[model samples]
Target: MFLDRVADNFLTQLVSEPTREGAPLDLLFTNREGLVSHVMVGGCLGKSDHEMIEFLIRGEVRRGVSRTATLDFQRADFGLFRSLVDRVPWEAVLKGKGVQESWTFFKKEILKAQEQAVPMCRKTSRKGRRLTWLNREIWLELRKKKRVYDLWKKGQATQEDYKDVMSNKRRAKGNLHPLLDVGGNIVTKDEEKAEVLNAFFASVFNSKTSCSQDTQPPELKDRDREQNEAPIMQGEMVTDLLHHLDTHESMGPDGIHSRVLRDLVEVLTKPLSIIYYRIIES
Candidate 1:
């Protein structure tokens, strides 16, 4: 038993009902007594073998709030967004400015208009969302599989019947199986499994190592190296590239969205080209 550390940590094990077969395999531990009660084994979820654990928290347990917000693209005002960027005179603003200065000014202008046009909403937690891919066919098939399993248990269905029902559950891709920890405890919950993997990776990561600090290449030996002209990039090329950017993709670390770029391609082409030109020239 896993009760040695449970007693040492002054925790109470509240689960008495078995989750599978006739053994109390699924354990529920709490630091406070009477905090959780009314523990029972509900039926399995989907085709999972282990039964679902049902319990209630006695008092108000305030969970931590996540302040992470994402852009509400459905209500974005692209008209105003483009208008704001169009009014900026890129040639005058970016004149006599270095590469970093040009990029910083461009980013500031874009972010300012983005805040006004694109509204932000709190990101919903994954546990509250349903899988979009789980359609009517998969649902009916799962029900049929459960019915077949019940019949098989009573010796009324053949093994091939159960196999036929299970063979159809492979339509969904990227399915994850239950993970077992080093201590042999089954981590069935998504959050618990994620934490276990994260902890393992963090334990093995070497943070003291550094890379590429002293690997700068030698200067070119050409006599005309200083006189060589930088490659020219036309505004049309930048506009074409921006138009081809997929709007469905997520924003990068710089907080600039692809949809906004595609929408304001004309306004951004000059500023982006100026920034790129300065970087190339340097």
Candidate 2:
């Protein structure tokens, strides 16, 4: 009656052997049609009474996409870049300008310099192969192993060769697994490990839900007001700013880097400062 309510089928057949004498010990029940692609029954583990059952399901899996753009820094012409910046008439063009106007002029000049010096090109993002650990020898070994695996799967190689290749592959993968700090706890399950990591990061960067009533509002004094109002930026100040730019950081969508600014600081400082002064006046 219960089986009628569910409308399921008995997947296992009755056998005359003693091991399968009574009811089907290993049973698989499915209500949905075409759900299970294939079923397999294998030997029992160690001294276990029940047999091992395995099945495959039909579906599609999606993979993540990796995309990136890179600048042709090797072919960059810094000398021409400096010459372009030096040729800009900073005093004549950017004088008596608004913030937007000054920005437009400076941006135009920078774009011209970039067009001449640092041209950008697109390419697929690469990893692992570039690392010192995964060298040419390792790559060759991996290729060879893969070829051997294919051959074995096609019944052209011995079982021992396939096992050896698999062992090497496992060893290589083991070396690449990221080591995470989980507060001295050993997490076996992936879900538990992810939860632990999420909790740790949440605690570190947690923000207050409400502002305290006791906190006072900020008041601008005379000096503070003067500081708030834009001041005339000097050539030396621009040069100093350029010198302090971080070289290790990546470029923006505009394909310009702080390293490029720093490299051309000597030529750009005076022109940039003039543009800044115009913005301050406006």
Candidate 3:
């Protein structure tokens, strides 16, 4: 009677072997076919009446490779990083050091702190992935429907039926919220959406591109130099540049984003000067 109630689409009894004296007690069930295969039985272990059951699980498993290391900023503990940097006596550390030496010391310490505060995570590849809304039960229903159709084609059934095989709720919600324009109007046309993206990509910072008389940094002053040799980098310029960095912009190849640089301006200014110093020297 229980087997009569269950449709051919629903429960699939995977384990066919009888565990104790011709009574099939040990069981395994899966709604989707071909998931569990090669049902095997072995002799029972010491003091155990139930025999060992072995089966291979087969399915669409995506073993992603080519992972990339990236900073997970959400989990970063900036307070820990700041405390680590503050515990050091910078004045003593950079007492008699040159620009390069001082920068090196700061870089070492900051990197050490950053390692613990912002640990790296391996980014998973999305080459071949399913949509967020598509789940396992939906997939099983699709397969069941397909099997019912095949059975009907072969004249094996009088009436074939399956329902609830697809879902569009998420897609309906997605369509409800379309792309908006600058003035907060929903854009429906493809051309309008394209225009919005083009406008965003073409936009640049509104800040001044050049320095006028009032804003020009004081000329670099380095006494230890050959004739006509460029002056050494000043801390003021480095600080100014860090301050002007647009937080909205994403990070470059160095993995250091504008927001992080601006946030750590005080600690990074001197070390950043060394970076510019080498550039000018080169």
What are the lDDT scores of the predictions, listed in order? 0.79, 0.66, 0.67
Please give, for residues 78-102, the per-residue lDDT of candidate 2 as tens digits.
Answer: 8888888888787678656767877
- In model 3, residue pairs whose N, Cα or C atoms come closer than 3 Å (at least 3 residues apart or on different chains), thus clashing, are none
Worst lDDT 10-window in candidate 3? 160-169
Off by over 4 Å in 2: 1-19, 22-25, 28-38, 56-62, 66-92, 111-234, 248-257, 279-282
1-282 in candidate 1: lDDT tens per residue? Answer: 566877789998777888888788888889987889888887999988888999998998676564778788789998998898888998899888999888989999999999999999874555225354454566777798889999999999999988876776765555345566668576668898898888777766654332356767567785443433543556666776787786766689989999889988978988998888787788
lDDT of 1: 0.79
Instruction: List runs of model 1 lying over 4 Å from the truth.
Output: 1-66, 126-231
Q: By descending TM-score, how would the candidates be arranged?
A: 1, 2, 3
lDDT of 2: 0.66
* CA RMSD of each candidate after superposition: 22.5, 21.5, 19.9
Predicted model with the maximum lDDT: 1
Model 1: ten consecutive residues of lowest lDDT: 222-231
**Alpha carbon deviation, residue 17, candidate 1 (Å):** 24
Provide TM-scores for the models: 0.45, 0.41, 0.36
lDDT of 3 by residue, 127-147 (tens): 226553444566776687788
User: Which residue pairs clash in candidate 2?
Assistant: none
- lDDT pick, better of 1 and 3: 1
